[model samples]
Target: MPETTAASSRTGRLLAAPLALILSVGSLTACGPTDDGPHADGTRPSSVTSPSVTSPSASGPSAPGAPSVPAAGKTAGTGPTTRHTASSSPAAGRDPDDPDDRLHQWMESGSIPMNASYHWPMLDTSARLADGEKFLFEEHCGARRTPETDSLARAAWMEKARPGKNDGDQNWLAQETIAAHLQDGKRKASALFGGLAKELQACGSAHTSVTYTTRDSRHVAATIVLDKDTARPTTLHEYLAVVGDNVLELSLWATPYHQDGGNKPDVAWPGPPDTSVFQAMTTPVCPQGKQC
Candidate 1:
């Protein structure tokens, strides 16, 4: 196993929070063509990576060691809603499907309600957030491997982890890679959100809102509304607590909508990062004006 540096660890914490948001909804949804939305060319994107399990190698635990499960019955309410920020808007030409459009006719007809709720153990805790970020990087960005297999691994992981099982070493690789990227300033807000918009567009709409709550509890929100449908799905919601210089406790949430009109289905649990069908997170060696 490769050693992760302290700076890399800090980056993992920050990136983990927001990156967790990106996978939350997608991981929770059921596996299927509808779940794996088509790409811009109307093709299903690849999945995230998974650890090789030829044998149960001696490692720490099946899941990353972190926050203990919340008290058996205690539940956290949906946090307060903050105003939207400007940078959160979707990109140009990225529009949402109209509520009245035939494409979204199922939702527009009201048979699905167009609204749903999803809840988990609140994996946003500092430790889990760090782990989640690591998973995203190793799985999507291919920090230690080539991108070709990384893409396939990501898609496969998403499909398999739909059940929420903790992934082994592969998950750790992803978490570490993401931490390194964020610490290097290669994964800033703009780049992070932009990539998220592109990913969400595959589901149904690309519009998104991002909210960050400071340690002091002050909340900041940013939104990007796709030009097509005008729907504002929340791609990242998190809390940033001061850690050290250039670092903070990052908590994240990613929610994509399959608008089913006024009667939307319950938001599915995207299981775990292990089964996500998306590219790994990586620092583009030479990005073009921040649009990696």
Candidate 2:
């Protein structure tokens, strides 16, 4: 990634953390669209290059002992209300009936509640044809081979800001979702999820611990607390859910201490935002052309 300024350099570092999760996908044979294109098994068109991660200024770290969810019926914002910094709606003129558009809609709506919760201005967002294999395999998160499926659509969002009271404090969160065309949605979901579970297993060690809150055939959720043995630890809550032919990946990252050596924020880390909207991506009715 090229950087013209210190801010861009820092953003790249921060973006890499989330993109690293993409690398864990390994080989996903039988995972992509069967229509004409680069085989989903791991090849990318020569034209498209891997995306670069980027960062922004700072926000305070997660408060010690923050609650993971807000009280029932209440939204999750902890500080005084802040003006919305970004729009969560889909672009105008998109065909509502297009399969890709439907997938984009799912990704956008699922993020609205979360974005509204903490004034987490959207730093970046992307909706593109699925082409993460080359990038994912490069990370080598213990997959035997790279995944081969080209999703019908893939969407990603990055949110970060200085929503804290202290200078140089920061909070970051990201979510990515992919919808594939598959004959057996359940089986494909299970297989891809196995890869994710494997990566999570490999990611745990002395510096970090993984605690799963939900694990089953269609959905999996876990929380990882890092640097727990040391001061200024951080937490990352991860979720994976397969709805029909769509799968959602979300990460809530909270640093309990400032990376810039600034004081902690006055507010607590607002835990994982509600994900029911994402969990329902393919329900009520499947996408126009999807097998689900």
Candidate 3:
């Protein structure tokens, strides 16, 4: 089985456009360890390009409509991009049920574990940038629509795991640039997550969009789909993975928000998508963050 993913990105008021599609997050490649390695200040780079597990798509990072925040009027990045007491990750062999095994539980814990079969897992190594498959949605910062408020210091991590036997019961996908940051970053993350979560459930029978910021201060854009009607209603869950300084995000889709009731419309949208590399909306997962 393959991992469920929803690709996305943010620029200003609009989210990176790649988010509009299930930009398949094929097997991911690293931007070289150093490209995503920790900095003296404990901060990661603004944008990173991970390798692809599958072949590159005709439409990739250069996909038109990807959002970005420009300089000038863009809001400032919040929190401590300059300092932090970097902590070690729990050993992969650590006990899963052991509460102590969740040192970076704040990162994602099991919010979006890979399904049973697929053993392929890709890790994200940035507090503020896209990781793994999210490499394609990268956007620069600018004078676009960034969160106006300042932010607090934050932390983040990423992974692309494959799950086998998606029994539809736990058959959901997600894509996130979730993180734990300063009050300001928290607010921004909250706004983007909350905004998308609310709308994912309300688009009765329509599609939606995604938006966020870049490390360079740019606004971005993405997209969302509407109401699902199937034996297993498409359920989408969007939230912040915050636990103290370790705040992160989870864009999981387990059930439908606005499941169709009355009758199957003439054109009942197909229930979600397949187990392709990248997933989207009810059918897929949110890309990076709002951006992803």
Candidate 4:
């Protein structure tokens, strides 16, 4: 086969699997008809592509010392609170329900419409965050956009290898499916992305107040964190963007300390690159900006 054809064929499997998990939440449960939202004609341009999937780089569980989940209802950020941020007011229009947009693709399949750094089996272990981190992830975890958020609908997720069972990959997975309230043709999805950025910031900030010794830095489009102090050193990165009435967010966590070969891995911390998670979130622009 020609090089171009062969390359496409090789990547096909990487893009097709793992879609089931992203779209499993079948109910459109929270949206109403568009009164003053999206295009006046109720139409959006066709999307050139749909949501794609990226397999993990082989998996295991949580970080080195992340504690197991405690009994339900015992965690931080437990109650809902009215929160505000700069330029984060959600619009009042309904997001357009286009079947071909990236949001729809994600809704149809529980998958991140992007390829992972490498493909590997999903780690069979359960989520395990440190005592404080666990509370933050299971409870304060900002992926779950709150009711105060201007989102009419949303889906959030994270995938990681069990720290002990993992095969030494340096990444995990995270995703959020957000449907924003649109108004006057603009989807105002940016507010949703902004909201998520704020949540992650809050999460990172909480890290300092807690006992976890995670090290982190921010990139233009995403944030990267390293946890070498744990039994298994892990790396995590994520990015978020708004598309029409939808916001796509992706995060990846990995553990490569086994390869570093030391109690404190000597590998130099590298800035997170523009991974497919970044590319997928940035792509899929609708002319009206709210239809996706």
Q: Compare the candidates by lDDT and give the number of the best one.
A: 2
lDDT of 2 by residue, 133-242 (tens): 31121122233432422221111221111122323433444444453433355566556556666666566778777788777766666777767677676666666666
* Candidate that scores best on TM-score: 2
Indicate the TM-score of model 3.
0.26
Error of 4 at 63 (Å): 69
Best-to-worst ranking by lDDT = 2, 4, 3, 1
Residue range 186-205, candidate 3, lDDT tens digits: 45555544433333233334
Instruction: Tell me how far the alpha carbon of residue 172 in candidate 4 is from the true structure, in angstroms, after superposition.
Output: 4.5
TM-score of 1: 0.20
lDDT of 4 by residue, 129-172 (tens): 11111111323343445564423232211112222222344334
Misplaced by over 4 Å in model 1 are: 1-234, 249-251, 254-258, 261-292
Order the candidate numbers by TM-score, best to worst: 2, 4, 3, 1
